[model samples]
Target: MNQGLIPSRYAKALFEYASEHDCDKLVFERMQALSEAFASEPSLVKAVRNPYVSRRDKIQLLTTASGSTEGDSAMTRFMELLADNNRLDMARDIALAYLKIYRREHNICLVTVTSAAPMAEAEEKRLKQLIQRHLGSATMEYNHLINPDLIGGFQVSIDNEKLDASVANELKQLRLKLLN
Candidate 1:
């Protein structure tokens, strides 16, 4: 389902709070960790959403996922608030929204490349250079990923714009055309 404005609103509120105390950077780091954890582990979402799990347990899980120290008040308080409101299930979405907000605030573009297999260092360097030529001085954060299901080829995304050249995608399009 579409997240709508709820996650964005939560993210903004958190960002504002962090900003008031010059802790936005810290919060961004925490959110980044949380977002990465959610991406790497699908089951974390389920655990957060599970009604049987106690709020304390969920908070502990979130703290651990953030890789924070013994107790970070901001992170701890935020988790508590989420748990209290039963909004923990939306934590990942909130974290992702916050990331976009942070990147925009910092004038950083997030570039991600996903391929069937890991690209060679030289190939990756050339790809990044190609991207830099197009971006023209925009500060960028690069992320590389492997999705074997792509079958072959690569996909590059600069912020919201995407170039898909995956064999799997081509096959899917061909299948649709043949069926029609």
Candidate 2:
């Protein structure tokens, strides 16, 4: 089976379980924290992925690393399933997939706004409103980033859609039009 397929399958199972228990949001948040912890501690990730390490050892390490958060039986069971299926290395992917499912269920959309410079509070608010209007979705989360290379204006991305209105892009378009 494909690597992605495996994680997605596990994620779907966990999502359903969480939904039934009405703990989907909690699980999603916990998984995200775990994923970030693992990413920041590459040594731990490497140890978990090492085939030389026994399953029991890996499980012990995971339990210790998870600390109080492992109190959730669902998460504990999910960890055991990962170890049993030898898919522990895909923990990050599984967490991400779970977050995606959770967001979809809550009708939350993540939007990224990249501008040439830091945006004013008013500008940010206006841009967020514009995005909400365009998406026609009440639940929108905005993440702002600054990229001076853009020269001016901004670019916004919500899911698979992108809206670009940077000065650099406009200049390129003008140059192309002149060439034609």
Candidate 3:
């Protein structure tokens, strides 16, 4: 009954349905775009969540906004599902859950690296290679971030696993050691 659980459940059902219909990839991509649009457009979110708006009007607006997109059916079904469950407000959560399912099914991992300074191309390449070697797949996506508070060195995270080698982390460890 948790709010987040509802979206994930709906997303899982939709994923299975899409897979059965052989439109999983297309629907997943469309859902991702729709979710991003919904997140970026405050007006769209407001309109969708407005209780006074008729269901038909909401559907028409979504259809018009999506215009000529190839995955209209999947989106339409998803919208209807949300409306029926009175969960239109959680559309973004459903879309994100669907994307997470899609990525897991496709064996994709998102890796993030943060450092005090931007990494050189060669350094990035080396890190990518190392990550790929460790993950045993060349299908990793990397995001880089510069955080000056790190002071030096870098940190890497792949899903829930984290490697922190930042100067700030080292200093904290040293301070703790001395305190103990």
TM-score of every model versus the real structure: 0.81, 0.82, 0.79
What's model 1's lDDT at 147? 99
Q: Clashes in model 3: which pairs?
A: none
Residue 172: error of model 2 in Å?
3.9
Model 3 deviation from the true structure expressed as Cα RMSD, one decimal place: 3.1
| Candidate numbers, best lDDT first, in rank order | 1, 2, 3
**Best by the lDDT measure:** 1
Give the poorly placed runs of model 2, Cα more than 4 Å off: 38-45, 53-70, 174-180
Q: Please tell me which predicted candidate would have the highest TM-score against the true structure.
A: 2
lDDT of 1 at 37: 98
Candidate 1, residue 175: the lDDT equals: 100
Is 2 or 3 the stronger prediction by TM-score? 2
Better of 1 and 2 by TM-score: 2
Cα lDDT tens digits, model 1, 53-122, are: 9999999999899876665788888888888777888889899999899898887889999999989999
TM-score of 2: 0.82
Q: Write the per-residue lDDT of candidate 3 for residues 49-163, one digit (tens) a residue.
A: 8989998778666655444254468778777777787887777788789988988888878799999999899988998889889888536867899999999999999877899
Question: Which residue window of length 10 is worst by lDDT in model 1?
Answer: 1-10
lDDT of 2 by residue, 52-109 (tens): 9998888767655554264678778878898988888887788878878778888988
